[model samples]
Target chain A: MLFDFAKSPIVSERQYDVCILGAGAAGIALALRLGRAGKRVALCEGGGLDYEDESQEIYAGHTFGDPYFDLDIARLRYFGGSTNHWGGYCRSFEPVDFNRGYLGDDFRWPITHDDILPYLPEACDIVEISSDYQDRLVDEELGLRQVDFKYSPPVRFGEKFQDEIERSKNIELFLNCNFTDLIGADRRVRSVKFRNYADQELELRASAVVFAMGGIDNSRQLLWMERRHGARFFDRDLPIGRYWMEHPHFTIGEALIKSWDQANLYFALTEKMQKSLGILGCGVVVEEQGDSTTKRLIKDLLCVAPGIGAWAADLAGKKLICSYRFHAAWEQAPNRENRVALSDRAVDRFGVPQSELHWRKARIDRETMLASTQQFNAFMLRENLGRLQLRDWVYQGDEYPDDDVLAGYHHMGGTRMSSTPRYGVVDGNCKVFGAENLYVAGSSLYTTAGYNNPTLAIVQFALRLADHLGKVV
Target chain B: MNRRFFSIAGFLALSLGHVPLFRRYFPQRIKNGWLLKDEDV
Candidate 1:
């Protein structure tokens, strides 16, 4: 049943098999899966049915390094979460992402890719995308592989599953319910407390509690909880908000190439090449331009190399040449310093400290994009297909331009999964290190962020977490 | 016929014909589109 916490009658205490905070992709997926299995679920959403400026204000905070979107605007604060404004791009993480031991312990995931492979079909069904992913190896030597991505009609969880959740016999969705704190002791959560806009409070007791809050808030709330309650809730030593990551997006350069069938194709280096080059994953998108752009590129080329420019002009006349804008969205290696911490001075209306994100691109991040671009350049030169004219900043190794698409707004890591508490916050099953009944679900639990969009993998992990919570609860 | 003049003119014409090849050997250095040298690649 649906109940707006602001309007619904006050219930001092309620009980459920599982209490899931946040009704975004992860929370909704987990709640639906558990409800289908006849488990009582309390799916709590911080925001109401639609967007509200007051509700969004809670996400406001400071960004210390790099040019980033304001915390409040980076993600939506309504029922469907950020899915309300997602681009619908979907691709699963490659096996190399999970088993990257060569990159170091920080890059390794406790679980293998095979562990999540079984759930791909169901995850694809949940997101309304095809399960088949066709990847073609374009050049074996250069390790250039043309990857396939499935686009969703971009399912908004709130719009699509509202009726089902409302009609669910075992699920109770509470909108406009903001999580305040957990009331428990001895590393076992007994109840969760939430307050509505009117400051009316409600407490929910559940055998299991899952924090499916979006990537940043998961760490922000946990950090606040740790500061408020100390080691009473969970291990205090676990990195609460460290190792945060993002996929940096930049228009690397322009390219002139012979007309090919693959026009808006995604390409990434193979695992072997990544290991050889000592770089992370990078996805390059080649967007073919029209005749006007081709002519413009020929004109630019004519100013530099007249011979190649004349040849390119001739090719353009014959309709054999194509101009492209090469863009790249690459993975940022997890750095302990790049983290989300609580702001010392600022607090929300509820008096909770706001999130202060410390994020910057490392040298390896630049190398990852540069290496991928160089590989593409080599492929073009080797095949006699085209030439790549890199941007001045890229070739010169200057600071990343602020005007470009700075990032994909794909927040990942922070409350990452690892085998031990020293390396990460959650275990392989996404259970908090010392907390028995508390678990985390979302991209925040990602051990390492790959170049693909996090929504598909977020649903997969939610489904997986639901399966785990099913047998226990 | 002036044989010496003819030889010089013929030589000049041949050199002119191979100007494109000389241009190929010493290509213009453009600021953008910086191609990686063989060793760098």
Candidate 2:
């Protein structure tokens, strides 16, 4: 049943089998699975049914280092969480993503891809996408493979699961109930506290508490909790707000290929090539440009070299040459400095410190995109397909252009999973280390962020977490 | 206004005046492999 926190019956304390702290994609998926298993759940959301200025203000914070989207505008705080505005690009993490021990201990995920494979079909169903993914090797020598990405109807969790949650006897969703903190002693959370917009407070006692909060919030809330109550809750040494990562998106260059038919094509380097080059994962998207763009490119070329440009223009006029824009969204290696910390001076309406994100693209990030582009360019040349012209910023080693897409709003890695507390905040089961009943869900649990969009993998991990909670709770 | 003569002149200008431009922007023959260095021309 759904209830507004401020208007609900006066229950100062309630008890449940499991209490999920954020009703986003991950939270909702886990709640539904546990609900089907007849587990009573308290699914709490910070915002109401829609976007509200008051709730969004809570996300307001400061960003340091490279330019990034405003903290408040980057994510939605409503019942659906950020899924309300997500583009629904779905792709699973490759096996290599889990086996990156060579990069460093912190880069390795505690679990393998096969651990999440069983939940793919069910997770794909929740987001309304097919499970089948087709990948073809376009160039064996260069290890360049054409990859596939499934588009979701872009399911908004609030609208899609509202009726089901309302009808389920095992699930009770509370809106406008922002999680304040976990109240516990010595690794066992006794109760979870929340505050409504009206300053009304509610607390719930559950056997298991899962923080399915969005990526930034999971780390922010944990950092705040540690400040208030020290190592009593979990391991103090855990890297709770470190190793944050994002997929750097930019228009790397323009290309003129021959006889291209697809509107968009995705390409990535194989694991072997990535190892050989000592780089991370990268996905290059080739999107065909219109006739006007082709004409403009030819006109620009005409001024630079009249003879070849005239020949190119003639071919374009005969519909022989195809113009394309090359956009690449690649992985950023996890850096300890690129992280999320609570602002000491700025606090939200709830008097909680706002997130202070420290993020900057590293040298390997540039090499990942540049190296991937070179591979693509080489493919075009060797196959007699055509040529590519890199953007001046990329070729000349200038700073990233501010006008282009700086990064995909895919927040990942704080509270990342690892085999031990030295490298991560969460264990292989997504449980907070040193805490028996506290767990985290969402992209925040990712040890390594691959080039693919994170929503598919987020849902998979949520379902896996639910299965684990079923046994314990 | 002979089209053939203008085309020849354009070709000569491109071949002589734009060698560096071609070497910089255009596709070159991949002799060793496709994985060019970070400073790939």
Give the top-scoring candidate (TM-score): 1
**What's the true lDDT of residue A428 in model 2?**
98
Candidate 2 Cα misplacement greater than 4 A, ranges: A303-311, B1-41
Q: Write the per-residue lDDT of candidate 1 for residues A1-473, one digit (tens) a residue.
A: 99898787558466799999999999999999999999999999999999999899989999999999999999998888999999889998899999777888888789999988888999899889999999999999989999999999999889999999999999999999899999989999999999988888889899999998899999999999999999988898789899999999999888888968767989999999999889899999999988787888788877766767777788888988899899999999999899999999899877789999999999889888878888887788777787677787776557899999999999999999999898899999999999989999999998899889999999999999999999998
Each candidate's fnat: 0.19, 0.00
Clashes of 2: 0
Interface RMSD for each of the candidates:
10.9, 10.8
Top candidate on DockQ is 1
lDDT of 1 at A36: 99
**How far out, in Å, is residue B41 in model 2?**
13
TM-score for candidate 2: 0.91
| Every candidate's lDDT | 0.88, 0.87
User: Residue B22 of model 1: what lDDT?
Assistant: 16
List the lowest-lDDT window of 10 residues for candidate 2 chain A.
A300-309
DockQ of each: 0.08, 0.02
